[model samples]
Each structure stands twice: as C-alpha cells, then as structure tokens.
Target: MLRRMFAPEGPTFRELAVQALSSVEHGYDLLAPKFDHTPFRTPESVLAPVSRALRELGPFGSGLDLCCGTGAGMDVLRQVCRERVTGVDISAGMLAVGRARETVPARAPRMEWVRADARALPFGPVFDLVVSFGAFGHFLPGERPGLFAQVRSVLRPGGRFAFPIAAPSRPGSAAYWMLAGFDAVMRVRNALWHPPFVMYYRPFRLSDVRAELARAGFAVRLHALPELGRRPDGSPRCRLVVATRAEAV
Candidate 1:
C-alpha cells in the first residue's frame, strides 16, 4: 500500500523498527524518508473535511501550521491566508522533505518554515489561524498544556487553533482492539526503553483536550464534519476542534 516501496531511499524493516524504538524527534527523522508513503501520514480524507470547515470560518490574514510534519496543513493555510503562511516543527529531516514538495500553487501566499519545538514556538501574536494534523499523539498528556499555550502565544487575539479529531472506536470492535494492542505494546516499550516516543492512540480524549485548551486560555468549540459520516451511536465520526483565543483588552 506504500508508494515509498518503489522509492530509491525507502526504509528497510530494521530501520523502521529502530525508529519505533527512538524518541519522537529521531523517530520522525528516520521515518521522514518514507513518511508520505506510510498510512501514518494524515490522509487526504481528513484534510478535505478540515479545509471545508476552515473555509467557512476563514479568509484569515496569516496562518501557522504547528507540528507540521511534511507540511500537509500548509496547503490548507495557503488556501486561506492572504498575507503569509508558516510551518513549524522540530524535525529538520521532515522539514527538508516538506520543503521539497510542490504542493503549494505559485500564486499562493508567501511561505516560511521554522525549526522549533511545539512546546516553545519562536513567534509572537502574529497569526490569525493555526492548524495541526495527526501530530498530537507525539506529546505526553502532561505536555498538552504547555503545547497548547505555545500555540496560543503565536495567535493574535480572536485567532483559532483548529484540528480534526476522530471518534473513539467502540469497545470490542476490530479497530478498538487494534488500537488497544498498539497502546499496550507502546506502554511496554516505553517501560523498557529510554527516550520514549509517547505516541499512544487512546489518551487524546476530546473532553480532556477541551479542558486543557481552556486552561491555556482558549474557548473551545466542536464542529462535526458530516462528510466523514457518523458512528453507530450517532456521534460524529470526526470533529474539528476550534479553539479561539478571546481578544485581550
């Protein structure tokens, strides 16, 4: 299923296994060679729904893509921002690959990339919109507050920090079992290894996320992306969390 199998620089099994055992930054650097080919890259399915939602709320001035692995969300920013777009992440290898892509149109807003950790952005209140995709699992639960605060710091008052979140799978379902097994293995691996990856699928709950965002001074709103359909319980199959910073008086 991976297109990277045909690429000249694709990773071997041993390289991937070593990546899985490394810290988050080093793991992504190792995976950067074939990241777009893997299922781990945020699918276009999720990106489309998020773009549609942002269009309804936007025509924003400047935008930022946080933890912007391979700059997928930068495409969204290019579409919505009139002035400029910026992408920030800690992994230079991933950013190198992202810079090589021809995804942005020629007439799009000016784009810049910064190499910085999400916990400590090197920006001020300059962005009117901010978005992240599929990168939250890299942070431990204890780090969420600081990460959210850093994002908030880069956004102008009334700007938003938005991203898509999928519904949790029902207990006993195949997907649930798969995620449970993955998390279990990850827990064991972290216990046995130094520099843990901190990528658990279960700890990113919407309720907890909202509370943490509020603690970082954002007012949270959830919008259902009906295009992705609904679960059996009628909850949205995926939601776009829109956390807006109130205007500072």
Candidate 2:
C-alpha cells in the first residue's frame, strides 16, 4: 500500500489517471519514464534469486525477455545465456528506456530490443530460454492459452519458458480483499471508460495457468523460488513455473 505513495520520479495521480484512460500500450508508454521508480517494476529481491536459479539451470545459447518492461529480466539472462539476449514489448517507450539500460560484459551476448506484441512476436523458434516478470495481469483470462502458445512458439525444442508466480492470497485475508477490490474497481472503470485498461489481479490462478500451458504444448514444472519463502501451510509463497517445449521424437 505504501509503495503506491509518492516517489521522487513517479507519475502523479493526474498523470496516472490520464494514462489509465488510454489503451494498455499507450498507458505503459506514458508510464515508462518513471516506471522503474514506481512499484510496478519487478524488485531486485525476486530477480536476484530467480537469476541464481536460472544460472543453475542454464548456459543457454539465447534468451528472450517476453513482455520485458524496462528489461529488468535481461540482467538475469545476461548472466546465464551465452549467445544472444533480446527484450520484446509492445511499448516503444518501455523499449527505449530498456535500450538505454544495456550493460555489456567482457564477453557479452548479443543484445536486441524489439518492439513487438507478445501475441504476434516476429521470431522463429530460436530462443533457448524465455522469461517474463510482472506483466501477466495485462493479459485477460481468455488470452492465456494464446499467450502461452506464443511463448511456446518462440522456444526451440526442449527450451524453457519460466516466470515466478505468487500463490494466491488466502480468502478473507487483507491481501485477497485488496486484490479483489482492485479488480472490482478496474472492472467498473473499464465499463465506464474507453479503450479498456485490461488488467485484473484475480484472474490468473496457478491451476488454470498450468492447464493452459499444458494445452499450449508445454510440459510444466513448478519449483519453489525459496527466496520468496513458504506460506504458513508450507506451500511455496511463490513458485517458478518452468514450461518446456517438447523435444523432437
């Protein structure tokens, strides 16, 4: 809740209101300049441990950061992938900020920033690994299978599509109500407004997502992202879903 408060470079309420009135692509474009300062960007705590896990799982030849807002996930890919790294998003403003953030090592992979919609990516099945963070809420529930198919479509045989998914907040809890309220407000806003902001926190359940990934031809595995820790019931608070495209028979 406090994270939604004022930040030195964060957008004002008026600016955010205007952005919310726009389409999703334009809204993100409007938000891109100060996106890193806002809480919407993926935090280092999650990224670091996910990076550690990726490094253990890979020496990947190439990687793509799907829906890469400001390219935060590229830092993880840079450490693990050997041949090439790419960040693709529909927002040119986000990609512009991300391009300025490029860091090259002594022997770095090739880097490319492509402005492309996630649903209609302009690439062959070439990436060895793919990852996304904090972007799925932008997609609708009905869009999940198509979205997963697109991710799977870009992966080479046996390549992995990975992302961290938080366990749903327990019912009747403050967290659950916060999410429920947010989605309720968003629904009303979209109903009353134009262009439709198209975000909802409650729709992306893990069970449904796993089923959709399976339907999209991915063999899915969930590994505890132990850095995010376990819930009181001992289930992981967050799990890294690794969905691999099938290898040729």
Query: Which tens-of-lDDT digit does each residue in 30-135 have in candidate 1?
Result: 8897888777778788888899999999999999999988888998888788999999999998999899884656678988988999998999899999999988
lDDT of 1: 0.89
Which candidate should be chosen as best, given TM-score against the real structure? 2
Looking at model 2, the pairs that clash are: none
Clashes of each: 0, 0
Kindly provide the TM-score of model 1 when superposed on the true structure, using C-alpha atoms: 0.94
Local distance difference test scores for all models: 0.89, 0.90
Weakest 10 consecutive residues of candidate 2 by summed lDDT: 1-10
Model 2, 1-249: lDDT tens per residue? 345545667888888889889999999999998888888889998999899888888889999999998999988899899999999999999999998877787899999999999989899999999999988999999888889888888899999999999999999999999999989989999999989998887888899998888888988998888888889999999989999997632
Clashing pairs in 1: none
Off by over 4 Å in 2: 1-4
